[model samples]
Target: MSKGKAHAALTIAGSDSGGGAGIQADLKTFSALGVFGTSAITAITAQNTQDVTAVEPISNEVVAAQIKAVLDDIRIHAVKIGMLGSPALIETVAQSLKDFDGPVVLDPVMLSKSGVALLPNDAVEALVSILVPRATVLTPNLPEAAKILGEDEARGDDAVLAQGHKILDLGAKAVVMKGGHAEGETCRDWLVTPEGATHLDAPRIETRNTHGTGCTLSSAIAAELAKGADLEAALTRAHGWLHGAIQAADQIDIGHGHGPVHHFHEVWT
Candidate 1:
């Protein structure tokens, strides 16, 4: 057996009480991908497949403490960041991660799939000013990207790609725009870096089990990074893994509404 610490990936997000998304999903993704998972929860949500009924942001002190505690003990090889509920908490997380040196996948989650707002209205500026600059890769869906770019909606590929480059100008090492919300038969994504942009396309899987897909994809990227995969390889592996998970989503019966993807599809298949 391998000795010493296992390949570690840290997820700084919220706790989904329903056990299908947020921290729960992130941890599952890390484990399924063969990486040890750690978490520092920023909020607690009483949510399930249907909706997020409640969200209680954790104290800033405790949030910082959790990050510190994990970093102090384990050598974090990669970091996956999700939902910071407020501007103060966003700053707190940014401050806590200031000393941590690793590839970070920042999932700028704005709202739950059920259309409940997660990030506060006022925290957008703080998130843009602080965390985006530090993020190794900022992953944002269409709505999130539109909000970040101060647009009512980001329309076509040209507009979406333009806004993506604009966000990258804010200082993230890279920007990945998720095209799930884009209108088309095929799902599209563009990875924008200083060098240029790479287009990635796949047939969008139609299923209600897309819950926590964003979290799973980002965490899988972190896991791949923990295993020392380069950016391209990491993203490719993560996308493939997530697609497989979605393809196998209906294998389990979890809840009444949207369900979760099979995180260990690779292992079982």
Candidate 2:
């Protein structure tokens, strides 16, 4: 057994039966980063790399109970939230985390890679009003950021930075505007905080196996935070780690369509 301060993180998210994204990816990332993972599943997604066929959210009471159970027992150093399927779920999660002071990495997973809306229209308001305020770090892709702000997708650096500041205005302590959806040779993720912005850029590795990139990145940051890294350090570590995972994605084959990043890429070899 490993001897040291045990790092644990709680993930409040959906479950993907295909083992590519959602809770599976969150847990995989936590384990890979040497953090113990706990979970409160908000929804169950019958999803594969190709599509999300069906989604069923757990009862709000059950979701709350799961979070309570974990917090009542374990020492969760950080929390990563993803895929809350409804307004009520978002409110519940926000209430559940109200007392905890640990870092909260909120990945606003609005749409699937195939363009299916994971979060509905009504719930967006609730997420903004309730959960966004509590987030220590809000991770949103280009389209997700646009949807959150009810604006057109940011096109240039100036537009993206303007939107990032707008999102910070919504009460998030920080925002990571992912550049994956943008047309670019280099994916440049902007880490915008109250102080300023930092550019996290990496060469775009061409690969179809990017099923859980967002989930993995956010969870990995939470994992790093659980290990006591500061906000910028955590984001930097997660970004670098995800780049490696995506680069090594072709080492394994999973689905017929977009496969998952290699969460254990460093260890599997």
Candidate 3:
């Protein structure tokens, strides 16, 4: 235990070779926000802005061991989970985090922007049954919310709020119902709990560089939570930061298709 170590948040997710999403995006967001970052990689992905060519999930034993190694030693303050490919892998993560007392930010990553599936059909059940109940805050896009609840994708505000409550009924303490898929000029993401709901609304920027927005936002929330921000405050701050990042995404040109947001937007200028 170092004397002056920063607040630490652990990201248990896949590795994106393109450095846009998953472990790479999570770590980048943590570092950008002055939080110490740690990771337990569940899978390795061969992807770019254009496509996800291949994916190789780490064995369950290895994934569990990675999580154990970090939890046993590091003083973790928060955890963000993403992209567990199978039922066994989801179960492994749930079991590994069973004893963790800090906030768990669960981002239900189902597919890439290029239409490549990340979580399989059967694994979605395990995620809802196992991990969703354990989540401190479940962050799910519109389609993901529908998938979790076995309903059609939510479109308008009323439907979105309705689904958000349904997700809270699944036993998550709260949910961030992302409105990226909704048809509107403003992107409104609801932070819904059993208590009530608030929103972080920003004007939707027209850009093709939204590759890792979900991963980045979830990890940013984790980082803020590690720094002792309450769930509402964390969502507000993370949303503002991500909006800035997305606005500055065009400043950098990395890939051919959907490029990454400028994670270092605050620092690199």
Candidate 4:
């Protein structure tokens, strides 16, 4: 068995009262991948499988304090960011992460599982300006990509790639535009960078347990990066891991609406 001080991954996001997405999902993904997890919650979400009824934004000072409390003491190898609930929080987190010289996986979580907007319209500009440029990798679904690109380009793979390139122009080092919501038998996730583009296509597993998919994917990517994988390798591994997670979740039932993925599907002794 491995024995040493556990390397850490910090997740800066929101609290999911349902324990399926946001900070909860991030922590679960980190733990399942054998990384010690820490968090700086930016919001408190009254959310479940069906909807998010309310969101209470955490104070920016407190969010910065949480980030400092972790980074000051622990040797955090990677960081995953999700769900900045407001423009102030976005600016706060972007500033905090600017000094964190580590692999940072950013999941642009703009909406809830039940199609509720988690981020306000005003915060989009802050996120684009402050956070996107510093990200080691940015993960955004088709709709979120559309929102960021200021158009609905979620219809075709080529259009999605075009939008991904547009996002790259915004300054992210790498962009992984997810194709889960796209109409197809296979789910294709595209990874684009200045070097070129790589495609990860997997057979779509029909299952309801996809609540925390974006969080899980970004956390898993951070996990792989913490374990010393490069951007392409990390994205590939995270894609397969999440595919397995979804497949393993097929037999389980967590809620009447979308359920949580099986993040620990590969656990063994």
Supply the global lDDT for candidate 1.
0.89
Model 2, residue 25: what's the lDDT? 98
TM-score of 2: 0.98
Per-residue C-alpha lDDT of model 4 across residues 1-269, encoded as one tens digit per residue: 28778778999999999888999999999888878899999999998887789899899999999999999999999999999978888888988876889998989999899988888899889899989998988999998998887897577777888888999999999999999999879899999999888899999888888999999999999988987789899888889989988998765677788998888888832
lDDT of 1 by residue, 76-102 (tens): 999999989888898898889888889
Model 1 per-residue lDDT at 155: 81
Q: Name the lDDT value of residue 254 in candidate 1.
A: 81
Top model number, lDDT: 3
Please, what is the TM-score per model?
0.96, 0.98, 0.98, 0.96
Clashing pairs in 3: none
lDDT of 3 by residue, 1-269 (tens): 36787799999999999999999999999999999999999999999999999999899999999999999999999999998999999999999998999999999999998899999999999999999999999999998999999999987888999999999888999999998888879999999999998888899899999999999999999999999999999999999999999999999988899999999999997
Q: How many backbone clashes does candidate 1 have?
A: 0
For candidate 2, give the lDDT. Answer: 0.94
List CA RMSD, all candidates.
Answer: 1.3, 1.0, 1.5, 1.4
User: Clash pairs of candidate 2?
Assistant: none
Better of 3 and 4 by TM-score: 3
Clashes of each: 0, 0, 0, 0
Candidate 2 worst ten-residue window by lDDT: 1-10
